[model samples]
Target chain A: MPISLPDLENAIRTAIPVAHLEIEDQSNGCGENYAIVVVSDAFEGKTTLARHRFINEVLKNEIAEMHAFSQKTFTPKQYEAHLQKST
Target chain B: MFRAAFRSSILSTRPSALLTSSPSSFSKSLLIARRNLTQEAKEKILDAVNATPVVLFMKGTPDQPQCGFSRAAIQILDMQGVPPEKLKTFNVLEDPELRSSIKEFSDWPTIPQLYVNGEFVGGCDILLGMHQSGELESLLEKNGVLPPIEGEATKSSS
Candidate 1:
């Protein structure tokens, strides 16, 4: 069975307790691929490697079944800057 | 592929087959039998990692990145103003064994894995984030991988 978007968010939120999340299903309803943008205090003071490792650890089971999983993680401040830049 | 590498290492080390009659050469078959593929792959992977400060095991070489993520990674390193000589990329697509075994070596189930000074950095997405935050540059400096960039160079020297 293909993994669902809610399932992906649920897994990340369970692990991270994220302040915000934006998930895009890039698999066109196949639910096999996704791109995620996560913002949370959990990322503060963490290196990119550590952050990715944490998310990977959290979604290990789900990710094993996924064909493509790409993500960009941000601390609250970084997310704010990214938001401001986008606007 | 492991066998191929071992064979090439044997050939390169002993260019003169006539003068080279070492017991080690005779024992190569035994070594091959005793040594598992995973162990050999790990050794090769480590060798590659240690070969350069920034090693990217990607789908293709820097000049012709086959995938979008690999291309993105090349661009990130480029943005850091790193010299091309300092970046060594192994095309995993050329060797199926290296491709699959690299995932096991890094414990990362993805292509386009980046290694800095024998340590695994995260993949392209992580790299992009690090680049944007200026963390990758600092990490390069911390690891003694790259020389400090323009403004930081003067500060460090002064």
Candidate 2:
């Protein structure tokens, strides 16, 4: 009756073909809380708030059953910059 | 005999009252405070923030902002003459605990927080407004560092 991390990851991947994605189960295995980082060109022209809205729209169904969701959405360019810096 | 009976009843009820509270419930506040942190983790985070004048808790670092807000935040600060080296950023993308703890620390639900003197100065919107009004310059002035604003070329465009 609860959504798993893989299920949440699938939902995000289905909605947006992101270059990179990380979903952390912050609910202490309670299946109610999640934190996600998604990188894609889909967010290129969007504002932060808009990107968040896009995710909310895509996950509207799962959200109803979820207790807390923390998200970080980035464009490909930004993700590339991040990747370069870390290395 | 009545006095002895009363003494026995009083002594018996005291142990039951104490037994009903578990060790956790007895130290509820301490437990709640410890729920999200190990003492060392909290100290490390606090130390990191305090050591850096401008701290950003974002999805990624300055060179790589993992979120639109994070990118915008870094860009805005850079545009204001606060270079990447002048800032200390934490990538919440890497650490889930730091991400949630930061939100709890600042009492602000948003990321890309700006801290000067280990105090929260607000997020992207506040930074943008301060940069435009030249208030950011004044704050930097008080800190004994003055740098020219970098967005002179795009000042009127926005």
Candidate 3:
């Protein structure tokens, strides 16, 4: 069963309380794949692996059912720099 | 043609010593063995992780990755000049137990996991970031996995 995009987001939101979050359904119709970019203060001091691990820990059950998952996590400060650079 | 790093040795010591150690060690060994390949698979995975300079556990071989993320990891390694011959890869599809057990061992949730000098470096996304920042190349070279600087070779030889 493909996990709902909202369900995945809500789980992340509940855990990380991200200020900004975007989910791209990269499943190509399978519904089991996703690409996520999440920004939160919770990530303030965490490494990429630690940030991802936190999210993964929060969404453990959902992740097992996933086919492909990729994420880019950022702290609020780092996300601001990224936004500025992209702009 | 990179061969998956094979474990340098086997766990011929048996579980007897661990059994006598403590309940924690007993359960830990059991986690390593788990349900998939049992004793053999764990030992093989551990051996490869320990012996190889750089190891990737992915969905398919480097020349023919079965997944997109795995493909990305290969590209990053290539960009870093981490030659295929120097790398060892384990296709998780070959063993169901390994696929799941690896996540447990590394406390990582994804495939295309990279390990350097026996440390879990993270999966494809972290590797991509590391590659962009030139950290991956230095990581390899620092560990003596990558070849020495080119100019130094001529200087030393002369």
Task: Indicate which candidate wins on DockQ.
Answer: 3
Candidate 3's residue-wise lDDT over B1-93, tens digit each?
122122212222232223222324322332332224356766777888988788999998888999989999988888778866668899998
What TM-score does the A-chain of candidate 1 achieve?
0.93
Give candidate 1 regions above 4 Å deviation. B1-37, B142-145, B153-158
RMSD of each: 14.6, 16.5, 11.7
What is the per-residue lDDT of model 1 for residues B1-158, given as tens digits with 9 covering 90 to 100?
Answer: 79755563464322222122232322231222212347878898989999898999898888899988899999899888777778888899999999888877776768889999898988988888778767888888887767767666423332
- In candidate 3, which residue pairs get closer than 3 Å at backbone N, Cα or C atoms, i.e. clash? B7-B47
Q: Which runs in model 3 stand beyond 4 Å of their true positions? A: B1-40, B147-158
Model 1 steric clash pairs: none
Q: Could you give the TM-score of chain B for each candidate, in order?
A: 0.70, 0.64, 0.67
Q: Candidate 1 vs candidate 2: which has greater lDDT?
A: 1
- In candidate 3, position A33 carries an lDDT of 86
Chain A only: list TM-scores of all candidates.
0.93, 0.87, 0.92
Which candidate leads in lDDT? 1
Q: Could you tell me which 10 consecutive residues in candidate 1 chain B have the lowest summed lDDT?
A: B26-35
Candidate achieving the largest TM-score: 3
